[model samples]
Target: MKKTINSLKIPVVFLLLVSAFIACDKDYSVIESDVLGDENSDFTTGDSLWSVTAYNKKLDSLQINNLGTTSISATAGNLLGVFNDPSYGLTTASIVSQLVPSTFSPEFDENPVVDSVVLNIPYYNTVVSYDEDNNPEYRLDSLFGDNDTPIKLTIYRSNYFLRDFDPNNPENVSQKYYSNGSSTENSALNGTSVIKFDDHIDNISNPIYSNAAFKPSNLATITTVGDGDDEVATKSGPALRKLLDNDYWKSVIIDKEGDPVLSSQSNFKNYFRGLYFKAEANTNDGSMLLLNIAATAANITMYYTSGADGSRTQETYVMNFSGNILNTFVNDYSIPLYDGDKILGDNELHLKGTEGSMAVVEIFSGKVDCDGDGILDLDAIDCFKQNYRQLDDNGDYVKDPITNRYKLKKLINEAQLVLTELDNLPTGSVEDYHTYDRIYAYDIKGNSTTLDYSIDPTTNTSDPLNSKIISLGQRNDTGVFKIRLTQHLNNILFTDSIAENTPTTIGLVLSNNVNYTDNAEILDSGDTVTTVPRASILSPRGTIIYGSTQNTDPKKRLQLKIFSSEAKD
Candidate 1:
């Protein structure tokens, strides 16, 4: 934000702001102060003059990983029958999860009777509203496909093991899959892969990750559970139920009684591997469903009668998916992006899905030469970084070097960040993410070796300072999310008592926050890592918003507005 002086005015009025800094409401007191009398008194009862500076810049793509969560989003935006997102294109996601071994081997009764071998995957439900019948309507959390709609889904045995991680590749050492542009040739993935990508045909050369023709499968039916006798009003929701193939289950688990692989977790993981759940739209114009395979009640139960012949009681061999970090189950998005013809010409930005473009916004993405170089290139130009001429109490420019820098001494009352969508955006049926309660400002600085700010290396999901993302809603006429960046901006503006400097660059994903936060998966160490999911469950359907780079209207572009006050020192 550039501040200009009024040169025309002869007698400049320098109003003295002398309010008690300790009194609450902070810097806002200046705007509503009603003190009269001496305009030059140092102890006047008035609000401080809180100045606002709007900083806007086009975001550059930064390297991010450890997002860990994969998403399955198939949407067709049809209000009538089945809804599909035709504008952005339809995409079905698949997942392959590694099963942690059973605690102990159980002996079956003589002539064991097989009742049923069923796989139950619970749907994501957050209790929100109730229906007319007083039936509890569940709000699906990580679900993005058409609600109350049907889509074809299948489960398969993965021929290849997920070579995403190993003991050689630790958490500190990030893998190539985490970053979009990391070195793939030397990705530390030792073993060969059996899963093939059929993207390139007879002539095409590039191997696509989304192509899943190489894997073998069995179909799983998606149906609503608790509809019949198992009706528990509170926990009633949809599920993907599949009867296990008798021969396959027996060979993998039942018949392998004395096998050493079944005795150990690591050996069994290498021998049998995991199951892949694949969802498909069938046609280009069908609906999609978002089912949470990592939910609490989702598992495969091997039903068998272990009781004596006359007694006959049922027993189960449960195959629970204990989300191991090394397993690396993820969503592979193969959807089309919002490629407006105009954007190609001007290189303009358009924020969309995970498969689409992401906006890289910064507090001050603009560059400046802090070392007094003739040209500006590296350092960011902002109120915190930029050096200015010292100002006196009379509001006149004072020649001082030591006290010239801006000091964030007072309490940071608040800072509002408003990101607006372009008027000439890609048109289509976009989910008001507010309704689904899915939008977040992710600190995507997972694999960055060098950043201007000091980020905690402990967790990659959230920044140490700013963790929660709360949407302020569409405040103005244009569709914009008014995000409160008080804590985020405060850290940037003020120097932490411990660390002398800030991060060089920080990443923020304006995507779904829940996908990165709400997780029911536990690691091998028995630690619950809910900070970030192994994959995102955000639907491929999305919205296109404008960046600060667009100059059509200054008021409609992305900008960071900081309202700060100076303490009465």
Candidate 2:
């Protein structure tokens, strides 16, 4: 077989062929050739006098399977919090991170004296407008709360220990914690959580009427923004600075009487454990802060006086939050993908991300019950079976009777899958504006199952490419993620009849969370387990899209374009 170059100039073979149907009125003049079989056909196996044809067509149906297994990521940015969205429902997000050693010296010298402890988090001003240069014109200095809807943010000691891999076997790199509650080492609130919500200047809600709403929290800031000579060299505006209990950390950092455990990062981690941030709405209604937990400026600062009263040398040991990969982020969406009151199956779908819902796609199988007749419709099944054939049922290659091969006037050089965006994104807030970068098709086949395939992200990172896995491109201007099903399509088109590859339906995932966690789900991608790493991008928001149920706009629906080579008739 001769190799061919696709539109991208990559040397590869396309294993996508389809049964012909005369539905659309394509230009009759463009029809250069066609393959027809009659009783006179006697073409054998090895024939060199044949022409190969290539063309394009769309899949008949794309069933969405609601694959609601474990959904979460390995790495992410921003510490999530509590908020009540009137339309979307309640959202609660939090941060679980490892704290490393701040100073290697392990000693507090110069007559150390306690000053204060604070947790600084920053957020953006709710969208006002932009200037000609695209800078935020008017900045409303506020955190995430408004209308004094009290939201109590609490800090607590993490109940679970975070490890890079399995703690039992240091050599085992597989067992690790994930965003979705799967791993055994998941951290929960087992200890007491101290409420850190007491920096209000004045509670004047008595004077202000209930009709008016105002922000009630610390600032999310940039440095250098204060009054006259009192202007400090350091900057602190637009930051959520919560005063942590001075006595608690003082016991751990200073009051320990020069504890040697605090000297080593590993010793301190085991002894002190870590911190967990939880947000409780208190009431069912409140605002949630969109925080950059991974911000270079975000931290927990411990201030101390290293010298005497008037001559004290003010020094600080900062607990950096975003540096370690051991950190785990979580987002809880209170709303279900389907209406709680209604009952629906996998065929009827819903897709969402972040603190939102999800839509699973069904694989191409199963029969239809259109006329309320439950029995599998024979005519419909026969039609589907015929349309999916690569060769005629009699075992003869589908080729021209005269030339002994198939050829065509046209071939599909490129095929792309496109999706439409729903206009239901939240307005005004910059944090809510961005969605996920890449969408993934997860393999759901487990062990004892013949469904074998591979999925590798061929973009963003430096991972090598595997031809067996179909990689979907990220969303473009048309609001759809164009995917390349070249490799997977080849398997379905050319495999032997006895051992046809089991095709797996894929779920749209925000992060590249393609881990073969379930023993049943295995990867025969032919590459090493080391090279096929599971990587993902963080998506803080969700969006609505046209599902297979929608019948309005032709472009908005889910579609698949197959580029195949045909035996010219």
Candidate 3:
């Protein structure tokens, strides 16, 4: 055996040397290694699946005052009417706006007789076609709920004075008003008595105007001026044109022409206060309209004939809806309760517009075993330090001495927050009427856009509807929303203290326009949410989406998927 081993060693050595020469000479160009070597590899790419905690948060009240000199075009249209959503319940929208005389003082001719007073508020419409007589046909836009259904609309004289400056603040800060009429928080801040619904002038007994069944019409309004051959017909787009009681206008405006009440804008505002467009549900489901109350064409025109009997000429006195215009809302929906553990998130997210609910999304929530089952909850998976921390010889995370936290070093290529709509939503006439096409995401703590939104190159300033469309992947055909958070995620990962800035919760709500990023202050009991997206306040639609705690179908649950690469050690 010893001799055989010694003899075999020489043969084995000689054979290996011959085989090595043969292999070197043979063509092996097609053979490739699957593994990317450390020297050759710049980074190792993989997807980091992170759990998202999403839950519905109820909005108590939203700031609805269009403050200062802000034009109506710059903001969402004044919502007026009632909409009974099958999912969100009843929403009554009303407007209380100050009226300003076109001129401070008026010098009327002799025998000024008030004829007719008309209030004109234009509707958002598009010219569909024109008839042979050059009369245009219109289609109403921005109308929610059943357009055929009617809402009880009443226009009243508001007795409460909306101030320009806060009376309580010595610094002369602007006054802030909320959507709820019962909210006394703003009044408490200004040291003034709250203006309740019953405080309006002639609201019940003698409103300025009342419509038991008010439904919007898409037909153009045509009026004939003059008589016989001298008559000229003027046509305008669809509008809510109502003739007010002539005697009322005469007593309030025409009769007070030379009085001190009509001497200046401030004087007129104080004397008249404002007009309130109060909306109530005439039926279980009524119509809602986005009104252009501040449009140039929208005004109260008082037609009066002046001068002698022989030279009686029809003159006009115009009053504009100006100054502190406020939109009040009455939401009669059940508030979503957070009964489950917040760390595990909620089952469904309720996102409604106006004074409705919004979803709060937390990214990279730490591990939590809520059920005490010796296993981490799937919804509470921690993907922060566990994925990015450096491992030592014992495979334990290497911690920094100064911060006392695991060191994280990873390059985030892309991070997307995926939201899936609930597929089994109730399907019916009211339920399927209007579905929101877009949803906006913002930093709740900062009350501003994320870095990704700011850096998105597709932001079209000219067209707000198209702004950030790519980054904010709107609801696709499959009913899914994928919002890019690449820059936002990178910022958190690269921050000096990951634990301090790790959980950046985001707010998700339906937006009328994403480009309208201006935030309106929220009046609530706590200081948790100070403001919300103003675009959301303008919309009346709502939707339901899957949250994180839906365990049956994990794929439908909200998640943050990050395409990342490991940094060089």
Q: Say which candidate scores most in TM-score.
A: 3
lDDT of 3: 0.72
Q: Candidate 2: what lDDT?
A: 0.39
Worst window of 10 by summed lDDT in candidate 2: 57-66
Q: Each model's C-alpha lDDT?
A: 0.39, 0.39, 0.72
**Alpha-carbon deviation at 218 in model 3, angstroms:** 1.2
Q: Give the count of colliding residue pairs in each prediction.
A: 28, 32, 0
lDDT of 3 at 555: 80
Residue-level lDDT tens digits of model 3 in 366-403: 66554558887544433354455556779776666885
Measured against the true structure, the TM-scores of the candidates, in listed sequence, are 0.60, 0.53, 0.80
lDDT, candidate 2, 330-405, per-residue tens = 3334444532111122222234333233444432323444344677554432222233343456844354468543
Model 2 TM-score on a 0 to 1 scale: 0.53
User: Native-vs-model 1 lDDT?
Assistant: 0.39
Comparing 1 and 2 on TM-score, the stronger one: 1
Which one wins by TM-score: 1 or 3?
3
Q: Distance (Å) between predicted and true CA of 482, model 2?
A: 5.7
